[model samples]
Target: MTLAPTRIEATPERAPDMRLYESLVARVSRPARYSGGELHSVTKAWDAHEVRVALAYPDLYDLGMANLGLMILYDIVNRRDDALAERVFSPWTDLEALLREHGEPLRSLETRHAVRDFDVLGVTLQYEACYTNVLNLLDLGGIAVRTADRAPEDTIVIAGGSGALSPEPLAPFIDAFVLGEGEEVMREVVDVVRAWKRDREAGGLPRIELHRRLAGVPGVYVPSVYAVDYHEDGRVREVRPLDGAAPGRVTRRVVESLEPPLTKPIVPFMEVVHDRATIEIQRGCTQGCRFCQAGMIYRPTRERSVDEVVRAAGELLDNTGYDELSLMSLSTTDHREIVPMVNALMDAYGDRGLKISIPSTRVDSFSVEVADAVARGKKHTLTLAPEAGSQRLRNTINKLVSEENILTAAENAFSNGWTSVKMYFMVGQPTETDFDVEEIVRVASAVKQIGRQHIGGRARVRVSTSNFIPKAHTPYQWVGQADPATLRRRHQILREGCRRAGVQFTWEEPEKSLLEAVLSRGDRRVAEVIESAWRGGAKFDSWSEHHDWSVWQASFEEHGVDPAFYAYRTRDLWETLPWAHIHGGTEPSYLRGEWMKTLNEEITLDCKRDPCNVCGMQTLDGDCRHKIAELVQMKVDGDSTQKERLMQERERLMMLPVISAP
Candidate 1:
């Protein structure tokens, strides 16, 4: 039975008084963030679009404005004639207090529409620390904080990102989660909501009806219909669906190719974290880094052709009038035609004083050469990720970079006129020892010595270490994170050693790492603790000035929850995890095998060059057939000589480093 579409009466919402808003903005810091009339921002008529979406990033505008994922979705939604998307972000403490005092609700940037009037409120969960801000933003927007309290006419809340893999912790708040990449799935979501709104207006359907319908959509996980059973030991025994509409396991959505790049992104009024025109040159990485969640989830490596990237770069620069452009990817230097692509970009735009940068790259001399080609003599600080201290630890984590690779890369950078080098490492990884921890300092000191050879007293080396957190959907998911005391001890070692060696050093806050672990690996029961924390004024936990550990501790105590149970407990091999049902291409068995390999310090080869390692994508959609064929054709076309030479050189330059413990 085909039902005719019904036009629902839009809710009446009062726009904020410009005079009052202007007065309030004048008093706050960075008022330009709220005064939004940026270039290229679309503000469609309110009555024209059938569906309105408020895309929010639960952080300050400075950082959220630079998020490529949010921008991509914004461009996608606004391109549709029947729909329009607006932007919102978590207000700073000063602004939040002011809004509360004035009884003003959070408003969208484009049209100043009250967020409550939108049909759907989509929040991107980029990191776990932003969880409290999600609740605060909803409350400040005049929406119910909990999904269960929302009425039929209230805006439906949905979330997506890498953090959506473990949806249990946020199940009570978010109505639905879009697992994996949201490029294609977002449109389907809009269609579903459009239809549900029509049906609800026609017959006054209940809120659960909308959830039931959304559950049928591919890649959407409606948490209310799912029930989790816990074991006697507080571990998750199973997560079964109550409604037949819900799938037993929600497989991640994958797009065959990355097309329709956002060429005309909105230029922010204020400076953002990354204030440059950017193009995603590719998606996914094939390097099997055991401790890396992004490497595990975003599999089967897809690339944008060199022509497409170059074309996109030109369009982006022209549209935004920005002097700099960035080719973004998980591994920017790993692109097959990176050399020719960089050369093409330099040839075309280098004369225009356009600066190009690659954010993420491998630790090798080849990466140095690519940087050199892009920079063309304007040398700056180069960032590299060694990940671990010693070669043995690197092997265990499948970093695949040797000691020679590190020294040679630094040497090449120094020789190429670069003045400073920044290295990133991780502490408290599985099987980490005191000797391994001290090696990080040794490596940094060695790089400083090498740098002095070229630019004495002018060369600088900085080492930044982050406490390792075991994330969901990775090989380290079952491993226990080191306690705060142990991590602090390791930090002390790094601090004293770097001080003695005349090297700059910094480290992440251990408590923040603990909170990240608890939230990332937590289950549904932890939702109570989250709410409690928010009630006790816990927002912006990512910022050190705003994060109050005592508040989190009080909330945990009030809710009768132990943070250590989630952060520092190693699960048995046969145990079911909180996110077992949220499958992201890789199977649990494959991850388990990888974990076993990590224990034995075994290395898994990258499937991009070698044969398939069977990382559980074979039985699923969007496997690595195209990537494999491309690599094979490159070899057949005689492009493997350079790769062979690099491999042989790595073998010849292999040497042990002599160093004393700090």
Candidate 2:
């Protein structure tokens, strides 16, 4: 017999105004966005903790509530007896207007307290398109948007996530930026802010002193304490530390293991983009794809043991009443014991009416088998990311899979009862040519043929190609972007090809990629351009209906900064890039070497099964080669006495040091 989930009774919140909320709830779409009585939500007493943190995402509630990083931080901070954390997200356009018209401040979901009342406001800068929404959120909170204009009483705004690696565009608005994985460093940040507050109450702490203290945190970057000098041509002459405590080079912080993360994630009241209890099967990828920023920034892949993963899956489903579970990773099929892990999960929970989801499988038949085993009724869509079309281009990008491998996987999916298939490809990749664009259509066509050959008349294919945006930490960071004209040509070529073949071809708008590139590679000089765009109504540029392309162009002209200089111009090896001083695990020399390999059309093997390529992540931890080798050897040596071997492996992994010097 199965027991029902234990529900934590809801606690009453201190109301700002009952009538105002009553009116707004009736008037708003999806009133659950502002309503806060979701089951299992934690709400400590207002005076229970010494420090208050408002964990905010510069996006909507359905979007922000799905972020696992913020949820982990919320659980970690609230678990501490000395600190409390609450959730806040950028309100939708309609709700923002109503709140502003009524003169109500942006508030937290837990206690209904104004955001300005919190001691620390940590916002996740996940995307460039959300910059304007950051200012809109700040203004609604009754707090000044610029860091320079903020009062001591205003909430200390800090930004992090992937965007923080190239944070110069947002430097003027965010008080501080966290540069790496936030799991381990978040508590350090909270502790520093807490101590600073204590000293402030003692009447001895100055703002500069607080900034200096914050700059001392392992992953924290205090932009105000750093001096940026630009040449007459708008390139950075130098980015030097003005304070002694701040390091001249701010390397991103890494969490050595995944064991310490929150296992029982928070459940949302309404539908989100991805609404499922999740288990992080692994962190980082060692595939060494040159164009992938996540591959370069997240180094020396670390994975959780299969036993730990199963335990967490059971607990999360039992605690949250979620009917689905997902084993999350950059590459889910690459896990050492993925087959046995999925088998174990399905064996345990398969009969309990739980659906398991996996994303971005390897281009192999084995991954298809894993998908088949997990997709109980074939009730979900199957997605594959070939990333490129021709084998030559695949080699250039270090996507080691071959054309035969892709068709074989598609064949497997179709034979196994998957009626629909989605393949992801990229345009404007480095060294891409017109022939390469044609090859994209050719590959999709081949995939569709394979599906049709197997599924008869039930084949449905979705082919999406997005423009390549050069990110800060990848090997292609120094390469010039494909101009709008080039992207338009490629889009046209793909459209004609897919149209003749009667396939669904969706491509990214070059305008969005242009703004993304400018924001990605721009320096502190680009801050005003972002401010100008926001002031000209550039909020929600990522959304199609709300995007104002004219406003972005006007903002660029107003700032007199040419988009081509940042987005279209190729950078020299010796140039002083904006994020040159911000380390992202892998060293620059390694990235340069990888770039040379890409130009040579060379391919790198996955280091998990091969010798270490020495990308510099080894200096952070022991090689991941040992990690997978040990697990495989353990399973073989134990002769399938799985429980004993699993326990031994889990203990060994948990005992490993979180960080180590080679």
Candidate 3:
């Protein structure tokens, strides 16, 4: 039998003095966002381990705990007897001001120990918007924001995740960036730290020597050992290795298979986003959405077998007692044996009242069956991401889903007891036009009509559109983002169209999206902008209530960096991106080809079901070409006829009339 998980409560013994932290909490808007005392939290004895590492998420506790990467590393590090890992998150604005007033530094939730006191600080760099928060955390921890200003005795700061895959923007702040998955690399790093601590205690070696040793680890990039060069145009020329160190290119690490992550996810005391249990049914995506950085960064799709998924769900249910389990993936329906997997889960736990959720379903009619099986009698909202309104613009970005299919999917969902439907689209994709925007309204109206006809008087249809931001390492990376004025105009058009069509429309602020674009595509020089922003009173930019655009504008001016240069200027395909030093499996040549294809309005077919186009993933893995080839063959043979049938069925489905049920 498996061992029961150890639970740690947040009591006075473990919680820090309220007076010490109260001042910091007062300055932050959300005080509870920082306080750790959530149910199912793990707190190990510090004395039991020689090395203690704090895995920090530079966001709020609620958002941080939901990340799968943090949970995976937490499980892997704590499973070892010699290493102890705890969690920390940036305190909300309310808590931050109170702590600053009292002159108290950031402390860990498990032990309330100063973050600077930990042996190592491993941060998960998930997004570019959190860059300012990273610098703020370092200052709060009493550490120098810049690596050069720190001494050898200071805690080693390391970062990993999708953001680190292109570490150029944050190169100056972090000592070293761990590329790709941390499950395997983290153990090696912890072991190195353990050995170094032992040597320090015994007077066997100097601390600087230990730092050098740690830098030699594979997949670790030490900024101090590399020199950056720039061309007259202010583009990166090269990132050359200093001395006899390894080349500047740091390869990402990938585990052959995924271990059951977060067998015991912390149960928050208060309501938070994604509060339910989550099981990552698969890693990576094969659909190859052209504008998505996640699709590019996390390459070579890998899925947990049905048995592993069911076992994980069972363990999560047994431990956390969560009513719903979300099967997470870039696209859950794309899993090869999705039907069998869902069936196995239902067979094992359906009688026990367990409901499985596929959060990232494809926008097709087949998804209706998957939803029906998992939901049973429970009514839930069905979401479809058509991405664009017009098929011509969709083909330009390689989002090949047709408007007819999306409507058909909605009809199936509404007919099967889904009372509400949500449709997702982006307004500022490459080659998007006023006609495309109008098409979005048309498609949404059609979907609403289908919902009313199928589900009658009790149903509603909602459409959500977000401003598009071009990101690094994707086909659209070189494309410019829509300026605020253009976005606002487009938003107004969408609102008027939706209102006329009697469809509820919601959209993210165009200004926030513009800021995200500035940060996302920014270079190393933009770090100064981030520092300035934080100093000028910018925290939690991800949250609308906390974000201050005025602060960011001032920071850009203070740093002498034009945000428009990064966010609104298109680049040549041959020009170097700021994150060119980090390799995200796929080759630059492949991405360039995809970019050219997009210009010609060519649809690069999905590799999941087509012949290997030599997209560079196979070359990165060296020997995994056979596996990739097999999967490609499976995709081609498995979906060709089905795709043809879907096209015909979609046309027939779209002809249905829209009427209100009385």
Candidate 4:
């Protein structure tokens, strides 16, 4: 349903400190960030709504406004009459300093209300770097960073997004974590708050009771309600629910049909990270990349019909007046009818001066064809993510695509109108070596030659490499990441090779990867590390200028928890994973099998064309794409009887016995 715009006014009590706002607005780099006016900004009378949510994105305004998840939840929450949602982004350094100087609490853009006044403060945990920023957001908004310290009057602090998949690191800070899609669960949260507000107004509702009520919500994980025991070896031993009303394992929420994947998102006044209309044509990936957490967490790939896509695109264009539209998906080219969808969009919008872009295109000629069909040889720069440099390493990580595929795709693009091809690569994979790192330059040099042959001297080959950090729910979760010495050595190899080959090379700082690993795989004990680092002046860590490695180093030392234990120590198969209680559609046994496949140099075919090779999505809802391909000529991943027994045993087995270890 298309929601109508409403004007929400700030009550006298909800109004922000105008004097503080006016004084600081002129001093910040972007004065517009402090201003509340924007096109299609919704507002309602503050007291009229039972619950007001200050949806905080723990990043700068420019980046936060571009988040599709933030925008999706913002729209969803505000659509309800009983609840209202407002946008709040972490202030830039200058504004943050000024706010502190003036003793003014952070406020929302719509109602200009102090962030603490909101009934719920829903923060988006999109990245590990945002952990410290979440603490900064809480402290700046007049709320305690720790859940235990927060008073009943404080806004309820809850978080969601990919970072929440393994939420142990931030468990002590957040009141609750939404395990999966927030479309339904966020509304449920608001409903609970609306009822509690009524009960609270009548008298006093115990804070513990309010949290108990929330624990009953599906996919809502109240860390306080669950007990986690750690072994002497620093590994998780068990996680048990306290009341039994809460589930021992919380299943992630998924939307079965992606009918309209959020088309008409809000438009930002100033430039943002991705300034365009976006349509999520598909939801999940079936590529089964061993190191990819998104692939494992979001399964049972669902695609929006081409007709529905066209309709959504048209409506978005008509409503937002945006000229650029991009198709979003885990693997955009793998969509069943991508070429036809691109061609239809181009045909429909060619005369209207539309710019079409697709992200996460596969490293194959078919992707080149789709790009050509959409942009009509007008686009100059084409991007591809090979992930690994060599085909062997690629196969080890289950990257499926070959060196030939990458070269052929570049050839196709160069033959069409692209002058430069940007490639993405990672060095710290599970089974990477010096040879593999050097091969990156070989591939880049080859692509440069192809571009030179096709475009004649205007060819450009640019490569960016970063270290891979193992994440929860992925097959690589049990493995440790590369240490600083190894990571830097690999980066140096790629950099020197690219230099010798005359290819432009860029690489991330090795320390960032180490910190990311610590944050990604950490348990509740690491929560102290996060807070200490933030208190020691660590914010905007994703930015190079603001990154202080010493802060993280100090925090790790203060907590007496070696960062290496979380990031560099390999795990035994039977060892309890910190995120064991967070089930993401697939069985741990299945993940163990996939992890073994990476070691055995075995590859599973894409279920779209070949047999089903069931990855547990079939058990979640239905077979991978039942509506389009309905013959049911699908095959399970393992022996049929074994798969059946494992499926039956999944319920009884809390920690599925790992079949093998790498």
C-alpha RMSD for every candidate: 6.1, 6.7, 5.6, 5.7
lDDT of candidate 1 over 320-420, digit per residue (tens): 88889988999999999999999988887778888998999799999999989888889989899999989889878888888888999999999889999
What TM-scores do the predictions have? 0.93, 0.92, 0.90, 0.92
Cα miss at 319, model 3 (Å)? 1.6
Report the C-alpha displacement of residue 413, candidate 2, in angstroms.
Answer: 1.7
Candidate 4 residue pairs in backbone clash: 7-43, 8-43, 8-44
lDDT of each: 0.87, 0.82, 0.77, 0.82
Worst lDDT 10-window in candidate 2: 653-662
Taking all chains together, the TM-score of candidate 1 against the true structure is 0.93
lDDT tens string, model 3, 279-365? 888888757789888888776778789988888788888887786889899889989889999899889888788878888878888
Question: 584, model 1: CA deviation in Å?
Answer: 1.2
Best by lDDT: 1
In candidate 2, the residue pairs with backbone N, CA or C atoms under 3 Å apart (3 or more residues apart, or in different chains) clash, namely none
Candidate 4 per-residue lDDT, tens place, 201-315, comes to 7878767667788888988888888888988877889987887667888888887765356765777778888889999988888788888889888877788898898988888
State model 3's lDDT: 0.77
Candidate 4: regions farther than 4 A off: 1-16, 623-662
Tell me how many residue pairs clash in candidate 1. 0
List model 2 lDDT by residue over 381-498, tens digit each: 6788888988778888988677877888888888888988888899999999999999989988887887789876678888899899998988899998999899999999999998
| Number of the predicted model whose TM-score against the real structure is largest | 1
